[model samples]
Target: MKNNNNKLLNQETLCIHAGKAKGDHKGALTTPLYQTSTFVFDSAEQGAARFAGEEEGYIYTRLGNPTTRELELKVAALEKMEDAAATATGMAAVSGAVLSFVEAGDHVIVSHAIYGCSFALFSHQFKKFGIDVTFVDMANKEALTAALKPNTKLLFAETPINPNLVVLDLQMIGDFCQQHNILSVVDNTFLSPILQTPVDFGIDIIIHSATKFLNGHGDVVAGIIVSSKENIAVIKSTILKDIGGTISPHDAWLILRGLKTLSIRMERHCKSAQTVAEYLHQHPMVKEVFYPGLPSHQGHKYLNNQMRGAGGVIGFELNGDVNTGRKFINSMNLFSLAVSLGDAESLIQHPASMTHSPYTQEERLAAGISDGLIRVSIGLEHTDDIIADLAQAFAHIENVTGKA
Candidate 1:
């Protein structure tokens, strides 16, 4: 409950105690949820001072709350950033961060392999505002260099990119952005801060869908942007405030509760995902396995250099056709057939039909998202049971395809 900023604490310790302070309510161990819409000031002068930014205190929930502030502080500490801003949802964070920096006619370079909603925001929503976005294969420096325009203001990428699992070189991208005087933003939702901290690699901004690994329980939908205090102040004053993408106090409290066990959950997630990826790689029904932990993965070397773990998600293709993919997912018992990832329970989904369906077939395939591809989010369940569930699913796929 004490501020341990003076002493360096391990990540697990930071997860539990980073933003925590001794509670006023009978010495509560956990931070209490201040669920009110507005806070009262002692006097009119105090209210005026708070409104004028001359004093520091919570005025309105839309602007800030104690619970949300605590969660923001926890994330900022975990990410090793100067500060952070929490948003209503993952897309809110992504859109708010982009809008905070760029204006009409500004160009941004984005990794082609990104979450479908994120791609839509840049390619469609931003385009409507006269902003130009060029999606390039960020792994290829030449491609990234060619995609950049003189007006390019931001470079956004997702390492261990969603569904596809392509690991971008964080240091390389950071250096490129520095040389070009561009803000480097990374969506570190996949690995979380426990496994990878992009700020350590010189990334200017770190974004996350706290609904994923940060929460680790799949109970809350939230987002956060971690960056220099200056950038966060700009975002807080303009985009986050004006756009009204503020997270609710209760949701923030839930995410804060989930953060306490993030390290332990992530360890299980990484270990189980590694075992599952290896199992699928050797399975006759699986044609390809896309997980950074696998030595055969294209980005395994970069992952080794940048991240501490391969993360929980695994992308792989079935040896058979699209129907085979459907059968495999349908046959799974323990692994739920759902879209979201990074939960305590395993999840399986077909990206071509689910998360990436917004893109045309050519676009999806170009980004290495195939119809037969299945994405599995390994959970805290025993590794053997997880593998057995996958094996049973694969067997069902074989039987259904007449390949048994």
Candidate 2:
């Protein structure tokens, strides 16, 4: 773990070995989980020194834990960041990254389309604290520039945006933020570090909902923020320490285990998603398919530059109404009707009713989220089986609508 050869290793190898604890745990191959709530100190002076920032050691679970620290280090390495801080949930990572920098009277510019809870946190929660938020289509350079104010401190957005699969130009956004002296934070949950690393485009911070792609098993609820060590220290000391959004060591351990297969998992996810998107695009019952992997998608152009892969999610509108969309979703046997994504099992959800419900109908529509839009997370299942499931669902919709 203490090698300078990390840069020489491939991502697949780094996933397994990077940030591994220094010494073998009694010759065990895996990193030992430090599950205790508290650690023993040599003396009262040492404990005091640790708390007073005069020494380096764990003072409490809220402040730090060895297991969580390993996860943070691993994620930081994967993201090509100086450091990272683990959190209890993805929203914690989002809130911590934003709140650590801005205060009352400050302004933030966010992508018009984003996850529901994040939209709520910025639009509703921040307003109560006297913080101003401007929701703009980050894909539009002029609109993003027009929304900026003198007090705007940061820009937050998601690439292959949630429920819509809209990819943003990271380099453009990063350059804009730097020119304006504002920070840039991106939600890498959809693509994870395996498919996209925002830091490579000069982004200031990268955030992930480890609950999604990073965990890959859908069992853990966790998050991480990667940035400069200085920014991480600020976040850990502020929103993470004061607001108490620390991740448990057990969740951190699960994520560490999940990281080992990330490269392979993403490969399957991308390949499967591409096939699924293509099928949906050609289906007679589908009105439009939105996936970066498809040449028809507006975001597809970024595939050659910013994103390494199109990811596992796809969004499409049916040729019929809301009821038809509902029938299609309920008709699927293999794809689970669930809100979360990046699981082994294929999952589907309605963004208008499920994930983007936090946005009012008007807001959702304005952001390009239609009432009939259906989103799916293509899983590790065989492509034939996955397509068969979708075909049956479409057949159900056809039967119900008497169309196609």
Candidate 3:
């Protein structure tokens, strides 16, 4: 049974204890792994009744499964939503959430600087279908408000946006969207629901690329869209099923396993990332640092008022040329040069060349992802050792560049 008591419970408790289904399985500690692809039905009539919504039970693996439902329920509970749907990947969640609410003639407003794939999907792909999109600087609320169209069906935002660590004022964005009677979709991937809940700020829909922080270890790839039950039904029945972006039973099990440690893992990730960010801020070799927690950051007030912690990613620019980005990346001893973030081991990468390589020089500059900018996804390593590794790397970088 969905608990109306959900409103009173603290979010930290939900992470560990929400979405538990009791059955006659001899008191298991965790959700049982129902690894079967297809479930057996009592009779053809029963199966038909289940499909017709007369009774609630598993029919086909593609449609729904017990394991997938558990994951959905748990994520929905954590996100403070009525229901949720898990998808094959992060982009699948974004695409489904967007297309579910919009039509060929509708319009959307999205943050100008977003995930690279999302950028292409909105400006290039969705436009082909005649869905006009307005990319706005979410930091500048005045600009965002001026860009809103009468036919805007949705307003999208990502806080502490991937690699960039740019924070968005959730309440400000949500309020503006509500005034215009438009749905607000927030990508809570960077902070996760552990640190901030978008629903609390009146956000209509919350999306997560569960592959990263939700899973914690970078082993599984999944996405979740959480919203009110009424909206969820429209999404689940329409684009969600027809588009067919469902996660496998094994991946669902993996996500369930990952949720158990989300709280403690985030604590370490936040602590270590702040340590690294502070170290870089004081370094002469670094020109600028983009982290929400830093007082010098543009979104400091919004971040302070809204979020509990800064988060694991830190973006800084090298003081030299484009080759400086390469020197900084190649000089690292502990950090691995990788693309994806929110893993247990410290991974760093040159976003200009690695993550946002699809964008041209002008495009990258417009997004605030500079040529010499390097993004590091701080992981759950010993803080002192992580700092030591980066300090040595900076020393090595100074040797190569004759600065700092």
TM-score of each: 0.98, 0.98, 0.96
Report the CA-based lDDT of candidate 2 relative to the real structure: 0.92
Candidate 2: count of backbone clashes, pairs at least 3 residues apart or interchain: 0
Tell me the tens digit of each residue's lDDT in model 2 across 343-364: 8989999999999999999999
Which candidate gets the maximum TM-score versus the true structure?
Answer: 2
Q: Tens digit of lDDT per residue, candidate 1, span 1-404?
A: 45557138788998988877544756687788999999999999999999999999889998999899889989998988888999999989998888999999889999888998998887778867899899899989999999989999998899989988999989899889999999989999999999999987889999999999998888888999999999999999999888899999999999998999999999988888888888889988778999999999987896656999999999999888888788788899999888888899999998888888777889888887888888989989888898888888877766677785
- By lDDT, the best candidate is 2
Candidates sorted on lDDT, descending: 2, 1, 3
lDDT of 3 by residue, 1-404 (tens): 23445667766667766776655546787777877878888999998899899998887776787778878888898887889988889998999899999989999999988888888889889978999998888989899988878788998889877668888888888888888899999999988888888887889999999998999888988898999998878777888789888878889889888888888888888888888888889988888999877889876777546887888888998788888678768877888888788889899988877777767788878878887888889998888888888888878778887885
Q: Given candidate 3, what's the lDDT at residue 50?
A: 90
List residue ranges in candidate 2 displaced over 4 A.
1-4
Comparison by TM-score, 1 against 2, better one = 2
Is candidate 1 or 3 superior in TM-score? 1
Lowest-lDDT window of 10 residues in candidate 3?
1-10
